[model samples]
Target: RAASYEEQGVDEIVILDVSATLEGRRTQAETVRAVRARLSIPLTVGGGVREPDDAARLLDAGADKVAINTAAVDDPTRLDRLAERFGRQCVVVAIDAARRLDGEGWEVVTHAGKNRTGRDAILWARQAVERGAGEVLLTSFDQDGTREGYDLALLRAAASAVAVPVIASGGAATVAHLHEALGAGADAVLAASIFHDGDMTVGTVKRALARLGARVRA
Candidate 1:
């Protein structure tokens, strides 16, 4: 699957072990190694990365960047530690944000969106960047898998609060959705259902983006 996405012209690939945090285990380094051996583009790996050693293992296994969620939320200093040990450019902060019930704003959620930390998502993005996270992976918990569209409001808020690149994720169903995300201030967009279900290919999406006047790699 990773090789196919690469072949289809994906600029990068992100593999997250969604169960690692919930299951209390580390991301399988062997799995990352296997996937890394097949791809030439950049790879980002995450899940259950609690310490610098964990991130190191993934990097040694061929991940260009290591993403952290639960651990960073549990201790913001962990981001500092990771960045200090492996350069800020190698650390990607993965934030799962869910809209508040009052509809006021979004709150940060950890452990794959099962735990709400009550931290303002926008503020957290700024804090994470200040703490040395080179990039922000913002996933809208409400929009994930819904395929209706990305939470443009959330994307705008987070992107505006941080200087680093922000990758919009969750709820992408159409080429227009990706275009809207970019217009909303996302540096990049991440989608799973549309690609995994065979509804679209990276090449097709890039073509559509190009038609929409958004620059895309060939």
Candidate 2:
């Protein structure tokens, strides 16, 4: 998949090992190492990074940046020290958030979306940046895997609250959805099922986004 993305002119690739968190292990560096050799674009790998050393191991495995979520809530200070050790540019904070039952606000979810921390998603994004996370990968768990569209309110809140770049994830089923995400203040948009299931090509999506004034290049 990463190889195909590189061929389709994706700006970058983020490879995540979803099972690692539940399994209590660091990111699969070997998997990242293989994917790195197949693409020229920057790669960000995330999964079960527990500490700065785990992140460093990913970097050594050829990932340009390392993303973390469960650890972000379990030990936010780790982000501070990681930024100090590896520079903020190499740290990406992944936020898996779901809307409250009453739909009032978003709460942070960890452990691969199994645990919900009461921390407000918007507030957490701001804190991540302040702790030196260079970017935010905001996933709306309520919208994830549904292909309905992003949670524009959640995107807007996180993007506006943080100084760092925000990448919107979950539920990009159409070009219009991508446009809406960008318009809502997300710096980038990420889709999994659309591309993984062969519903859309990166080139086609990029062209579509460009028509919507996204400045995408061929």
In Å, residue 16's CA in model 2 sits off its true spot by 1.1
**Native-to-model Cα distance after best TM-score fit, residue 123 in candidate 2, in Å:** 0.6
lDDT of 1 by residue, 3-51 (tens): 9999999999999898999999999999999999999999999999999
- For model 2, residues 104-207, the per-residue Cα lDDT tens digits are 89999877677878888888889999999999999999889888999999988887788889999998899899999999999988888888888889999998
For this target, which candidate reaches the highest lDDT against the unseen true structure? 1
Question: Quick one: best TM-score, which candidate?
Answer: 1
| TM-scores for candidates 1 onward, in order | 0.98, 0.97
What's the count of clashing pairs in each model shown? 0, 0
